[model samples]
Target: MSARIHKLIVGLTLALPLSCGGSDSDGGGKTAELTPGEKLCKSLQDYVTQCGAATPCDTALVQDCSSIVDLLSEPFMNGVSECINRGEGSMTACLTAGFGALTPTNAHTGLAASFCSECAFGAPGCEGAFFSEDNPDTAILGKAILPFSDSLVSEVSTDCATGLGCAGSFLSCTQGVIAQRAIPESTVQCLVDNLTGQAPPPPAGQETCVVEGSGGAGGMGGTGGNAGSGNASGTGGNSGSGNAGGTGGNAGASGGG
Candidate 1:
């Protein structure tokens, strides 16, 4: 939760399509060795079922649980996996309690807030110990984050404090976060340009909230696919998502794609 751990687990961070690639079988019917990303994806899916928070996003898209790959950070995943495996009941409950009914497309956003508590704030949580300083998710979220605004904090915190912001909707929480942006346009623009290996789209929010920049144009599709190709998934596709950035500020159930 380098970006906002407790707040994330405590209900501070996240938004994603969420998935890893389908398992590939070998020519002779032997299963090929699983890549690190695929292994983690399997583990997370298992955990989701184990916790009763299983989602059908990938299945709905026919990606077959391949969308939420790689996650935003390995460190983040490691920390979360460790914490969830620690036998804490609250963590398990947090998975379901933080958000309401989930859908395949918006599960990532909801899970982000649910994981905030132990993942970022608790002793056994991943909060400070993990979290990459600069990953696609953080880059996109960082651009939208606004720690300096008291009013924004108060407003977001009101619901987030309940460990359930956005009216018990993770998608709504993501949009709320985006609306509070303070990061510079140039900085976010740089993220799209270099990270996606493409020219950045128009900067989101002028100098305030962003559109996340790369969209489907890069990251998951273009250069970042180096490993993004059905792997652990960038920010789940492996980046914070130029697509989410595009909808981050919009008011609807569809923001934070």
Candidate 2:
């Protein structure tokens, strides 16, 4: 909601370069040794270098990049991975395919591949960064989905201070798109496999819930049936006594025994 956050989102969400037609032209061709994801990652790193050098240490751009890195790293990886697994060429490829699936001829759809690829893999410490930790699976799988900054914008609108909620929404949306556009049922299975390794403690309500009894002592007593016309003698006599206290006093009894 703050102006700073607004500026950050706007900067990150700016229109990105795109390349459609599935050709690896524009110097982004896949190397003989590299997977689609690796190629896309390299392109993203190149974009970041170009962008940073173009601005020469712009604070707003730096801040925006840092915020994006913090908020969207995991989602970017998940979405890209899912896209790769779903048979898309790479993350950029997947974005292109997804946009194509919805609207094939739109110029923006073709351009989205470049835009999303750069955004997804742009951050310094992110998976596709030039100095990133070594992880081939991440690099390849990360190619399957688009960047999730749009989802994050909605989240920031609601809670800008902590941005935790926005982060969660962005991740969830990223994973959801991966499942929807790329892998059909892989997300659930992947999560199940992950949780199987680490046995999480059961949730609070799943363990126990207690209820206390608070009825008065006499509250459970049942009313006696109407007295019969004849004399009655029983072992369990009513406890009522006195004019007011007596229950079913001999109202119908005659002068006889």
Candidate 3:
């Protein structure tokens, strides 16, 4: 065959799918449009189905998914509302922070410790189930719970920074706010101490130094400093405390006018 004819045949073959509009096996391959809530619910349902198929029959997983969705409905709605209120940038930051906080690596150990103490007051068996090491149900429950927890946290982190109360799932919301602000470990402990009516001891060892500005004193050039730190003094403040420190003027010699 001539080279031009060969190329033309190849092009025709490639164009076949586009002309036919994909496959017919999956009902003509027409994509069905879903509303936002429907789409979200479908995704959740698909995840549960896949997990169930892969793992053992987990009654707890079903219950956990149901409970989490129910518990999180208000919070999720509130989060969406808050995100809309804050504009895209802040909303994106809040969502990113919230998701980051919920990752297995960053899930708050302190908040986990306090789960039973504070969260149990209203969440019924959540504290017990969440804290119990022996519970096989926890894994499924944890996974199911993560979505709502993360959503609540994201909403709270966004809203709270704007001086608004997050409308649902207080524990997750508060944890999220703390995480988003990148609150210091000492400050977390201090808050915990205050909750329990105990005095918080100062952070140990040499006080850490925090450089100021959007990216420290060097702008983007400086390494991102630790969240909260002290200078030469003992008064290290919380990271992202939003408190302005005293501005330092240029140093002068004794002989200078």
Candidate 4:
């Protein structure tokens, strides 16, 4: 990557915090250092705050306080670095690009929760999410659905951003996780129960995803779920039923043929 990014990655860790006996010497870049995730997240929040570009996917919104911590990890930072290294524009833009869209199976990124709750939830349309008092079920639906982010990441990598974060939703275009039935059925039932009545959707997709996530848990109905999720534990679902079911399940149920 670039020299600046190299400094940011390796050297920043060595830069002592002012609190840790480090001091400002001359007029220069702020002496204190932030980890890669912190740096990227700060840049993202700043971009969202200034730009108001929280549309299809708001890069700054955090559904839970815990997720902010989750968002900052080495792999995720690497993804961010990869995006920047290859000449992507801004932090948020690179995030939208999936470090520049590598996975053909998933598209339209900005899937995961934002790191900055203040900037994200306080933005404009976020009151409808976790803090909602109108219907607690709304949050339930949200929580029920978005865990796709985890399973998706789990299925692909231990890291969240490296997998579904880049894809932008819980539902993959390849139908890998769905076919495998990676998500719990209880979560599916919860989603089905709440989706219709709440009037609002999940804060974002774990299942309902960032760009266009297809809700694939069991509650989509036996026809829907069985059709979509092959319950693939990798190759088992892939060859046995994953792709076949994904393609055939809906059509067979509808019986268009």
Considering every candidate listed, which one attains the maximal TM-score? 4
For model 3, residues 1-257, the per-residue Cα lDDT tens digits are: 99999999999999998766655656656678754344334433443343222222122223333332332333342443333233322221222223323333133223433443443443556544653436644332233234344454344434432322322254344544544545444443333232222332223321121112123332222222323223332322233223344333323223312
Give TM-scores for every candidate, taking all chains together and pairing residue i with residue i. Answer: 0.22, 0.17, 0.19, 0.26
Model 3 CA deviation exceeding 4 Å by range: 1-19, 22-67, 70-105, 108-110, 113-148, 153-257
The lDDT of each candidate is 0.33, 0.34, 0.36, 0.36
Q: Which candidate would rank higher by TM-score, 1 or 3?
A: 1
lDDT of 2 at 73: 32
- How good is model 4 by TM-score? 0.26
Error of 2 at 59 (Å): 50
> Candidate 1 at residue 34, lDDT?
66
Candidate 2, superposed: residue stretches over 4 Å from native: 1-131, 135-171, 181-257
Q: Compute the lDDT of residue 69 as modeled in candidate 1.
A: 27
Ranking by TM-score: 4, 1, 3, 2
Residue range 199-250, candidate 2, lDDT tens digits: 2322444212111112212233433434334455323334444334345433
Error of 4 at 221 (Å): 64
Task: Give the C-alpha lDDT of model 1.
Answer: 0.33
Instruction: Please give the clash total of every predicted structure, in order.
Output: 40, 9, 0, 13
lDDT of 4 at 159: 28
Candidate 1 residue spans exceeding 4 A from truth = 1-36, 54-65, 89-257
